[model samples]
Target: MRIDGRARALIAADDRGLLYGDGLFETLRVRAGVCPLWDRHVARLRVGCRRLRLPPPAAGALERDRDALIAGAADAVLRITWTRGSGMRGYAPPLAATPRCVLALAPAPAIPVHWYARGIRVRFCDVRLARQPRLAGIKHLNRLEQVLARAEWRDAAIAEGLMLDTGGHVIGATAANVFAVIDDMLVTPRLDQAGVAGVGRAVLLDAFPKTRVRALRRTDLERASEVLLVSAVRGALPVRRLDARRLPVGPWAR
Candidate 1:
């Protein structure tokens, strides 16, 4: 763990991220000392900085931090977190503040090989995500909604949980973006309402020009011929079952 480009474990006690969760984070999959989709992750982090009204981390600094942490690990999960440094005793941010960047590396989760080919099971989370257009599409520090949703299921059979916005529109999975193929057309939930615009989903959309971004409902998912979940760290995974609905592993998931 490194704090603000230093080999430090302690952060300011009054940091807004610790006080009020005013921060953003990006997780990257490092393979053989490289973050393959780092450019895309940085692009997302830049947008997050703009939305959160904080200065972006220097490109050079970020690269150096990545190199130092992943030097020995052949495979790792690199998390880059940025917080609106120590602030006064209120919601209003200080006039002048230095953002805090913390880089943490950990062993990547070993996903079952069959999950990539045979797919996994999922269920709808009872917790509905609140619509916050300003915070939508960014991986913000405030993730209590996801936490609650994830806690809704503890069964090992359920690999992931799908979440919906308060407006009854399907948003995404607890930790991945959800994409579906309906009527022979590919589509994903729009992030303008609520959801993270993930790098994996972005790559998929870019690779498949016919993919559409729109509001999706439970019925849409029910009618989908195939469903896939994507995360920057976990890659692509097909959904073999959603609750009682048994789905098929699609060619696109490969």
Candidate 2:
């Protein structure tokens, strides 16, 4: 792990990130010592910093850290966390809070190859996401909602859990973005209300023409011809069964 461009493993106890969840993070998929989506990750991190009123990390500095951490590994998972450094005892942030950055590298998990070929089963989570437009679409540090949603299911057969917002609109899965084919049109739920806009989802939106970003309800997913759960680490995984609705592993997902 590297903290502020230095090798370190500890962070200040009074850090605003620990106290108030005032931070942002990015998880990138590394392949052969290269991050194919580094640009998109950095772009999203900058946007998140702006939304959270935190200074964004310098691109050059970030690149150096990433390179150092990867260290010519064949493949890895990189996680970058930016926090609003330690502050005095109060909710108000320091006038010039120097942001703290921690970059870590880990070996990629050995996901079952079959998961990519055959669709994965998912279930609807009982925990509903709270609507927070200001924090929506940003991969912020406050993920207790996701933790709770994930804990709702313990069956290993279920690969993921689909979450709905308080308004009963489908936001996506616990750790990925949702895409579905509706009447021959590619549709994904808009993240202006809640959920993270992952790098993989961005790639898909840019690659596919006429992909619609709109409010999606449970019924919309139920009626879709195909459904895919996309993430930076896992790419795209087809949703075979979502709450008893058995979907097909469409060709597009493959």
lDDT of 1 by residue, 25-142 (tens): 9999988888999999999999999999988997699888878889978899999999989888999998887899999999999899999979999999999999999999999999
TM-score of 1: 0.98
When superposed on Cα atoms, how far off is each prediction in RMSD? 0.9, 0.9
Candidate 2: residue 4 lDDT (0-100) = 93
Alpha carbon deviation, residue 211, candidate 1 (Å): 0.3
Candidate 2 structure lDDT? 0.93
What total of clashing residue pairs does each candidate reach?
Answer: 0, 0
Whole-model lDDT per candidate: 0.92, 0.93
If candidate 2 were superposed on the true structure by all CA atoms, what would the RMSD be? 0.9
